[model samples]
Target: MRSIIAFFLFIFLIHSVQAAPLLQATISRESQVIGNDGVTHTSVFQERMYRDQNNVWLERVLPKHHQHSTDAKNKTSHKHLDLSETAQHYFLDNKKSTRLNLVLPEDKTVIHLQTVDIEMLGLTNCWTCVFSIFDSQSVKKMKITQQGNGYTWYESQNAKNKIKIKWAKLQPDQNPHPTSEYYATMDSIWKIHLERICRLWGLNLVKE
Candidate 1:
């Protein structure tokens, strides 16, 4: 009887870990730019992030009136901007192999990246870091300062361009779906490089 009870308990523990709910959070991004006329323009947007034990999903909320051009000739060759409704899913296995799938709902297309180098692309192992959309190299060049609260502020500038980011503490999410099938794909190389780069920059990487 004791052995049987122990076996059942072990099974239950395994099931609990496999069925754990995803962690969700809302990420807000604000951009300010000074035009040639010396006018400051500001824009804000929000994204949703969901994370499970081994996967992450990032959804970019688009405006309801947002339109997509179907003109093939007018289409830009840039893979990142060609999407209408953008979402990304990342899968990481126990061995640290990573894969990404870029889901474009409007175009009904999914871009699969079988192998990705996160450092080369300026990405980190932390899912939240994706909110910045800037490569790790660029992030290294940016200035980081602690805000009054738990928030962190980042800023970067060049002769003709400037960017700023404010990172807030993550809050508990009430709803998050299971890992979806849309996002990019990566390999272990990505994991290795991303961890190294993040460490070099004194950035934290979420480990599960």
Candidate 2:
């Protein structure tokens, strides 16, 4: 009877841990856009994400050259990519469906994003939606090839346009999330003025 009780308690403990695991990570990436005129533009981006039982946070900073707008927020140590410093923030359970905030310090607008927008962000949701990348329809359209323990996502339809996705430094178990992620695309080189991660996760800056 004692052995059976211990066995059941051990199983219960394992199940409890598996039910909900905490994820906290920061992913950095460098991207370049190759123009048709043979000019290539490079940018650096960083994403900080943290989630536990009741609280959540996510922030993304794009290269000054790639400065664009959407909505999201937060603060982490970041490097100066250039003069164009732009960013955004989101709140998962903020109650409001939509919102927009202007950040004076960065000289750009931040869009308040909903958690539901992960479907539109592809692997970026690795910042918020830990499991969505595996199920996103957009990701499903790409060819995902395993790289050691990581996976690489790339466009299979267009030859000239390219977007590369890779994740590294995943945790051993219990709701693993990547410690680093890489994303790059050249499809909209001419059209987009800025590339932001507003819809990636609803986050508010820790300070001004």
Alpha carbon lDDT at 128, candidate 1: 31
Residue 147 in candidate 1 has what lDDT? 61
Candidate 1 lDDT by residue in tens digits, 27-66 = 5554455567777666666666655555666676688886
CA deviation > 4 Å runs, candidate 1: 1-18, 35-37, 70-84, 114-208
Q: Estimate each model's TM-score.
A: 0.44, 0.39
Clashes of each: 13, 12
